[model samples]
Target: MNGNTERQFATNVYYDRTFDCDAAKILPGEFYYTGQDMLIVTVLGSCVAACIRDRVTGLGGMNHFMLPDGGDPASPVSASMRYGTFAMEVLINELLKAGARRENLEAKVFGGGAVLRGFTAMNVGERNAAFVMNYLKTEQIRVVAEDLNDIYPRKVYFFPRTGKVLVKKLMQTQNDTVAKRELDYASRLKVEPVAGEIDLF
Candidate 1:
């Protein structure tokens, strides 16, 4: 709870009758966490989302991130882990502030697709997926579920309180929108770091 006592929510969402709770949609380079029962959603291409929760307290969060280009292998490893580290830490810290314990956190990860069709030689999808998994492992967080690496775009819906995640893989014809968004996001990272201050939970 920052200065704004009001809870932040997603806007312009079309209600889906399939789920009973209200939905909060997250876009590229954004993340959200809460103790409420509302659903958190996001569409993904090459970017990865780590859905983490404290099983006991039911406090959870999800972060969407793409690793920036690793220039100069000679640079310190910390420089390369910058964006990924920030994404992971923000989500985890928010959950902790909401009463989650570090030892009780479990994770579910999704989205790392090769949908861009060789746009970058570095294979960003693979790197993003690998980076998140390694980061979680290094932090001793157990990943309970994962849907990583493939050629399809996916829509993810996460229920923070219950730790339920529904993933729908889209057909090739329907992937254009997500691919373009993710590609644009990846391109933006090269020129500038993520804009704005990290949201205080």
Candidate 2:
């Protein structure tokens, strides 16, 4: 069956069983893909979330990633971008396997806030936004919408089937848990060894 027909069938079958299903929450370094009507949700600070969907097939997914710094820029695609590359690839590949067309893919990106003060020198948010924008461009995917590089956290809700996205800029509270979580993740990346890499060739 073609992408559209498959999606329609799935929707019809699911609608009767579970109408208006709750959203599946995606945390940092994770992604979720489906053709169903349920929403994909995530909260972000310096981390970036790419909500990508195929206009033709209604297949889509969202990924949250923090570009680990201090890697060799000249390394392979998988190494240079660290978890960022993996996150992007996994989302896109899953969409394709579920019948999404490469040419018809569209993206809605969010987060990348400079909500954490100590990482100002690193400019983590700015770098992540730039990386995602450039990566999508290189892959020839059109970014239909984006809200990035601000000073506040955001809550993003993405509906895969319709390619719709809703973003809410969060209030700056004293105990900004989202920003703190992203900051902690970034800090951990600095000390962890690059995955799937070895010195002996």
Candidate 3:
């Protein structure tokens, strides 16, 4: 297994009293998938999450990520694009490995909020929103739902087994933590090397 694959799987598993089920919380640059009935959750600010599932088999997962700024936009194989591709591929490959058929995959996307200061000028949230949609389209995954490019941070709850997603848009006043987390994540992306390549099966 690649170091990126091992590091990107969300490890914070716990039980959620509100939903009364097992849950995994994924942060920026992380993802989670399961064949069992469980919830995968994340908070987003200037980031995006893709929830993908096999409608027939109910095997699914979610990935949270942001493309770092400053890559050559004209090049399709730029560093930022590579990072985003890895993020999506890791989740999809895991699902396929667990028996999800490629033809059965569908997607619901969320987040891409302009909650971070100084990022609005470059429209980081909009860039992330566009990248995810385009990536799914290129991979031929049908997107059944989406909520993107808003000014408020969002908390996303994904039940992969049921292909159900609940999104709560946070008021700007409630976004301090979300903003801080994403800012720190973006900082890390600038200095840290992007994860190694992941090929879709």
Candidate 4:
């Protein structure tokens, strides 16, 4: 079936199911499922997730991106949606391709928190939040809701059928952040993420 049909099926079949923690199985950075009533979800940290929905039809899809750069030669499509610039383009394009009118498209963004310690919470969240909002404005897309710029992490839920997004501010005290920082530092030092063609951040 096409993406449109899949959306319809998702709306009709699983609208009332639980989508917490390991709910809908969206591939890394990319995910799609019939939510006829099910809540599709994805987790994020330094990354940002965009929830796009058709204003009229209510069909929607959410993508999680790690950096602003997707299509990074080193970052395959599997993880590219986790990037900022590419993720925005890809989600928007996919929405249009699925029969969503650009004029009728609504976007909701979440994440980009500096969850890791030692990292200047100096606003990576602000920058990512700004990047997505600015892109939406430039593209003429309407931003229906935005829960951003907080020091704490968030858990967001996107209801495709009605296009309602639920945001929960997860209180991650210093203790929570410090642990994440150590792990992030080790990964960052080990895996040097290559830059993509365009630096969207």
Candidate 5:
């Protein structure tokens, strides 16, 4: 495993009474994958999550991430893109390591809400939405479903074993927590160096 993978893997495992299954809640820059039947969840504000799984084996995972403030979107190796790349690669590589095949991968993406105030100029939500879609396309992973940029924050629940996702769009009035968390995550990105390179498998 690479350094980034070690640091970014989600560790908040819990049992969800509501779903009667194990669950992992991934925060910004974190990802979770498992071959066992389980739920992976996250809340997003100007960030995105990709729930990827193998159609044949039901092995999969989810990742929550946002590209840092600025970088040339056209340059695949730019700093911001690199952060996004590592977030994605770490999740996909983990799934592959757990016995998922490259040919059977499919994706469902959600989040990237324009709920953050004073961030309209940067279009952070829009950029993140675009980046994930483009990245999946370049990787030849089929996007089975998506709920991209909008003006409301979202709570995403993903069942990797069944390739099922449930998305709840939060009212603008109730988005304070989501906004604050993402804002703090973005600030940390500005100061912390991006995790080391992770090669996609």
Candidate 6:
């Protein structure tokens, strides 16, 4: 048996509670799921994850983030979700809080695309992909599936209760997304305030 398959699991549910996953935005590392409910989610960029589940309890959560903080003492748990450092922490904590044990967790990963223009070959997508793979490797979490590292954006739906995901590839491979991102970045750039001079009469 493969090392991963030997460690994988499937959780079954007897009853489910429905939760409305509306347009409400979820930040990085923030996992959302009802105990027995199926969830549909969406994201529009490059990121990577370890989607962990408990087979016996039918509980699970996914960790999707970019940078790894390497267990820094100063690491903010909230910020770690945005970065790789605390993403695993947040996911594990969320799942544990929901009553899943560490041994029962399995994973599926997605995202990490380089769809924008002019980022050379190795960019955030590549970095994110690498970090996720390395993190999963170190953690020994079994990856059930992975869809990553292309020149297109994807929309993802994660069913936490069932550990199933549906992905849709978006086909805007031009500079449109780049232009929009650049515009937004430019808008956020700070300019120094001009010092006021006394007006001469």
The candidate 4 region of ten consecutive residues with least summed lDDT is 1-10
Q: Which residue runs of candidate 5 sit more than 4 Å off their true CA positions?
A: 1-7
- Model 5 residue 139 CA deviation in Å: 0.4
List clashing residue pairs in candidate 2: none
What is the number of residue pairs that collide in model 5? 0
| Model 6 alpha-carbon miss at residue 153, Å | 0.9
- Each candidate: how many clashes? 1, 0, 0, 13, 0, 2
Model 6: number of backbone collisions: 2
Order by lDDT, highest first: 5, 3, 1, 2, 4, 6
lDDT of 5 by residue, 1-201 (tens): 333532488999999999999999999878889888999999988999999999999999999988888778778888888888878888898889899999999999998888876764678898899999999999999999999998999999999889999999889988988888898888877777767677777
Pairs of residues clashing in candidate 3: none
The list of candidate 3 runs beyond 4 A from truth reads: 1-7
Model 4 Cα RMSD, Å? 8.1
- Greater-lDDT candidate between 2 and 5: 5
> What would the per-residue lDDT of candidate 4 be over residues 140-193, giving only the tens digit for each residue?
778878776666677677778788777777777533653354345334422444
Order by TM-score, highest first = 3, 5, 1, 2, 4, 6
Q: Estimated TM-score per prediction? A: 0.85, 0.81, 0.94, 0.66, 0.94, 0.64
lDDT of 1 by residue, 6-117 (tens): 1123353445578977777877777888788878899988889999999998888787877766654233354445677677877887788879998999999999898887
Taking the tens digit of each residue's C-alpha lDDT, what string does model 3 give over 1-201?
333632388999999999999999999988999989999999988899999999998999999998888877447898877777888888899899999999999999998887776764577888889899999999999999999988999999999888889999889998888988888888778777766667788
Candidate 3 vs candidate 4, TM-score winner: 3
